[model samples]
Target: MPEQPQWSERTLDMPPQDPWADQPTAPGTVPTPPPPADPAPFSRGRAQVNPQPHHTQRYAEHEPTGIGWPGAEAPGAPHGMTWRWSELRRGSEWTTAAVLFAFVCWGIWALSGGGPLGTPLIVFAVTLAVAVGVFCLARVVGYVVLERQFGRRRRTARGSHLVTALFLAGVGVADLQQTQWVMDAYHWVAGQIS
Candidate 1:
């Protein structure tokens, strides 16, 4: 059998290696070279525990200032008339459509002999007042329901206005058919306009 190689002779043939070869050394021992300075200008690994607010956020906290109404003044109006008009103006288009629909319906009803014959003008005016009041109440209820179910950002559905207008038109047409006087007046007006 051949003789085995000795462990001492194998160690003698290799050069000595240092354990701290990867660590950096300071030149002339000057404050350890300031810890070899961070390789990157910003730390990419760590996350920000406390972040700063954006610049625009500071300005957004302030309330806006401007004229409430332009080119409109109430010289002898009531105390709350301007505020009431502002509220009315700010109402949604759907509410306006509903109020208009109510007026149209009231006119048709009045023209179709819906009120007392003794005092026709008074009856018509009363009917109109009641119709408008009911319609305004209904609009307020609708807005409240929508705001409660959805958020305040919700708007009236387009289909609702279409449906309401179509129904009122149908009612008006039926009422107009029953009233010969209104039909005659309408025809006379159309002929004069043409």
Candidate 2:
């Protein structure tokens, strides 16, 4: 027969293993997680315990001072009767530059005999007509849909339709005359160049 295994009384009475038993601790102290960091003054999640009145006053004092609509003012315009160049330059510097460059290139190409003057002239006429149509459509939509349905009044729309119509009619007459002027100018430049 195999020899019987010896079992000590201390081993028999001992409790099961505790994972945290080896960790150092004071006689009566317990371990705790670290305290959280202080929240920022304007953090999203944290509430403002003490809101500053001066900040609100400062923001209220700064009123918005420029035309709200894009392209509402002429290029290189001053602040009087239109948006200043500084205001228009914000977020639109590249776009403004690109449009001016395109116009310059188009003028050079037209003068260089890229195609018959009629092609670009007719295209410009059609573009002007479409622009006027879209402008009128927008006015109608603003007055009927936005103002009536949404109860948001666009005060400018009241007389803007008449003004825009008159302006577009004048532009149409000018556009018709512009073709002859452009052709004359292009020929004059071509004569000087050759």
Candidate 3:
């Protein structure tokens, strides 16, 4: 049989008082009973605990998102290789396209007046038509495609369309001002020649 292990020798000694017991009773040392709890965060009248302000107003309708806006988790947005039309406008696509088209048309019109086939004017006209047509097509296509893919309209977040329109108008004004300066210079040169 295995021998039983011997228990420790017994000794009598009083347990020391807790060191913190005599510390001057902290103010409000009496524990505050936690306020009676309610199952819900808010309640009214008697027995109410942890009441939160009530909100009864409704929110305006907002567009849903799938790629860029809140609650979007598109596989083709800003991360992976999935063809998305919205990606085009993400990198100044429309703005750049508009500017380029304007530049090309202006160049052709300024370099050569309307004439036969292959003339600068003819080229300018063709390009102008294509650019305008394509831009219109792209705008429609972009809204459709992104709407389908993201489940949300591709409009800007806040006064987006208005802001963009205003910006375009400002740009047009600046361009017209420059054109006026150029035409004045041309007139001055012509006057000198005459």
**lDDT for each residue of candidate 2 in 120-163, tens digit (9 for 90 to 100):** 66755564566457545655665566555664534344343344
TM of each candidate vs. truth:
0.30, 0.27, 0.26
What ranges in model 2 sit over 4 Å off? 1-113, 157-194
Residue pairs clashing, model 3: none
Expressed as tens digits, the lDDT of each residue in 72-94 for candidate 1 is 33232222212244344443465
Task: Give the best candidate by TM-score.
Answer: 1
Q: Candidate 1, residue 37: CA error in Å?
A: 42
lDDT of each: 0.51, 0.51, 0.50
lDDT of model 1, residue 189: 95
Could you tell me the C-alpha RMSD of candidate 2 in Å? 18.7
Query: Cα lDDT of model 3 overall?
Result: 0.50
- Sorted on TM-score, highest at the top, how do the candidates line up? 1, 2, 3
Model 1 C-alpha RMSD vs. true structure (Å) is 16.0
- Candidate 1 accuracy as TM-score: 0.30
Regions of candidate 3 where Cα sits further than 4 Å from its true position? 1-118, 156-194
